[model samples]
Target: MAFDFDLFVIGGGSGGVRAARTAAATGAKVAVAEESRMGGTCVIRGCVPKKLMVFASEFGAEAALARDYGWSAEPGEFDWKRFQTHLKGELDRLEEVYRSLLKQSDVTIHDSRARVTGPQEVALADGTTVTAKTILVATGGRPVRPDIACSDLGIVSDDIFGLKTLPKSILIIGGGYIACEFACILNGLGVEVTQYYRGAQILRGFDDEARGLVAEAMRERGINLHLGTNIVEMARAEDRWEGPVPTASDAAMSQALKGAASPLARREGGAHRPGEAGPIWVKGTNGQQDVYDQVLFATGRTPNTEGMGLQDVGVKVNRRGAIEVDAYSQTAVPSIYAIGDVTDRIQLTPVAIREGMAFTETVFKNNPTAPDHELVASAVFTQPELGTVGMTEEQAREQEPVEIYCTSFRPMRSAFAGRPDRVLMKLIVSQASQKVLGCQIVAPGAGEMIQLAGIAVKMGATKEDFDRTVAVHPTISEELVTMKTPMRTA
Candidate 1:
């Protein structure tokens, strides 16, 4: 007899695992395939490990501050090698926990990659296949590498978490949320970090005021900001591009194909690669590339859909390799669906988990519901941290008349801590109805605190509702409640 199941989830990421487990709970047989560990990207590469590193880096600054707080100790150094090992141990434990949970729930764990072989059938990387009543793609996305001349010079978010040692310096090459957070994490830890954005500003999709202010704060922190500039061109040409060693032959070929310069520059103050411990050359846009021990890439994520036979089943994908799905996560091939980063809608971990849950209720339980995505609040665990919910002041003004109220001030703690970093909060309200159109927060723990506002904003809270709430005294969050006059409310 051929074994069959009610649901088969491809890509054992947060969304896929969640959907599988939830479906299994409904007395449906479920099978989940994963080429990597369980726990998905958030657990393995994206958020969890990145945050662990962020927390580790913050201690470097906090140790110095502890003296000001009257606590003193013999200053030690950070061991990047051991930290990586510990992080790996933690991730392994978490992955085991996820696998155990799935097993206890009796969900079949296929230890391989899965692809949509047909409408309701999936082919595993091992060549065997599974046929189910429905298929779910939760493959998630991965970091994208650039096409610079120094192929060895580039790195991505995926490669940073497993770093054996903390870098002395880094150049992050994106303006998106990922790059911004990494710049914060790296710079806060005392690494000389530089950010390169193609536009005149960073955080392109965010509000204008918020974007401008964050850039200022980043600059204040000594983050080398190169705005309105792309990598222009990078090469191993030592004389032109800066580097410590000679260019690898393949690197030279790549540069030649791109028409980049060929004068490989000499090293500055002498540098060596850690592993091979050899002189390696790299070129940067400044025409002055220093020999650094490491490079952390923070560009963007590509949905993990390659080689995962999605199109074989007639599944639709956008130009960016993100799976195409309707509001209910339904694909053109009705029986096969996708959620989370694979769908490329809202690529947050919590959003993926929610979409997974919603999918199970709608399909297996027959509830037929859609995941709520409006006013979804998210945070970036940067040095000051950032939290945001609802629309932005700019986004609100496009539709109708909006009122904008923005405030920038140092929080009370900053006075004592003497940190130049300030808190920024903004609110967008509709002129006709006084409804809160958007909310943006830039401060410590902004991401953690924004969840409360997220609920209210999703429920269609108005600016009046914000006013109704009494201000909590001596707190940074209270600024949201105490907006006096509008800067520009549409």
Candidate 2:
């Protein structure tokens, strides 16, 4: 059956772009429609920009350390305008690179929103209907505010990059990686950060000992973290304050004035407006009432399956609104496929890209491949990062008897500087097979360390295998190999 193209991709995110490019390379005509930027969540807002902020946020601590080392270093005020200008240029360049890559692969770019009109058909925002032999949906998820009154007054994670001036005081709500990471980032950047988590601890579902250390480190770094706390009510400070209320610091006020002419400050909804609205007055479940220059909700993310007409086209979606797909990413409708965050199968960008490749191999190359979702390593970019791979000790013990090898100590750099910071290295080992079931690290460069450790874990390396390797001495990661005894057996 001849159609307009061999493949029609609904989203131009990392997954969709990769699938489109790879499928087009196979001599199949392909086209992609993107309502927004080509890079999607990762390159545009989620990872790239947030990591840059994390990097920018760390200099203050580094400067303090340099002074302790007798380098006579002093941290200066962070210029949000200067950093944001550079960030905007970088994002623009990345978007252009994505467009160029897609064009090089001979894939058509629609540059508009698309919906699945029927089986093997797509309707673009521009009133154009395109039919294809196969359809791929990679529309990623979006950060959503909680269903509470005055929630719209608060900004989501996406709004952070668009903020013209950094708030002097921010009340961050949630305990996930996004919440904790930003709490540390804003705190490091000298914002008065108050974090509230409804859960008993932050970073739920992570290794308990690792998250505990992270929570402690965050408190030591001056983040007012409150566990088992949630916002009961919130309103604009102007409505509650009887007189003039001061929201931000003098420096932040000056920065806001300088950025007043920028469109971002005046933009309505989604983007943060520094001076347009006054401070936010929040009442927590713990009975604490306070005002913050800004309130950030890292509450959660929702898949972008709404209004795509998935159900109308016989594609099944779960209660959470994620498109249901089989092992090879094929949906209930045989010609339709979904990948990345839309599938809700491992929301990591790399995982999404892998799924896209597998989809291309299965449909275009005639070689069926299923993307492996096991033992995926991930990192939380907090002040003291947490890098982890495989099952947590809790999950490992539930399946079989396990041994926990863990250690916490003051690292050389911070200890020398008389800081109370400590790093944690832990391994959850299977007693039956003597295999390293999991590995977790909480320290500087944990992200880099976990990538290498993940390789070993992914290969099903046993404890003896790790023990056989020589330790890289004078390093935090060396503890992974050198720890000879289990702290506890469960």
lDDT of each: 0.77, 0.90
**RMSDs, each prediction?**
5.0, 5.1
Residue range 268-288, candidate 2, lDDT tens digits? 334435333557767789877
Error of 2 at 203 (Å): 0.7
Q: Which stretches of candidate 1 lie over 4 Å from their true place?
A: 1-3, 69-75, 233-262, 265-290
| Top TM-score prediction, candidate number | 2
Work out the TM-score per prediction: 0.89, 0.95
Q: How far does residue 254 in candidate 1 sit from its true spot (Å)?
A: 23
In candidate 1, residue 118 scores what lDDT? Answer: 79
Candidate 1 residue-wise lDDT, 1-490, digit = tens: 3449889888787888889989999999999999888998999987899899788877766776676667874347777788888998999999998999899889999989776777877787888977898888888888877766454455677777655556665667788888988888778766777677777788877877777878888898789888865564443234344434342334453344345545545334333332222222344465534333444556678888888777766887889999889989999999888899988999899899999999999998989989988777887776677778877776778899988888999887766767777888888888898888778988877877688877777788888788889999999989999997898645
Q: In model 2, which runs have C-alpha deviations exceeding 4 angstroms? A: 248-276
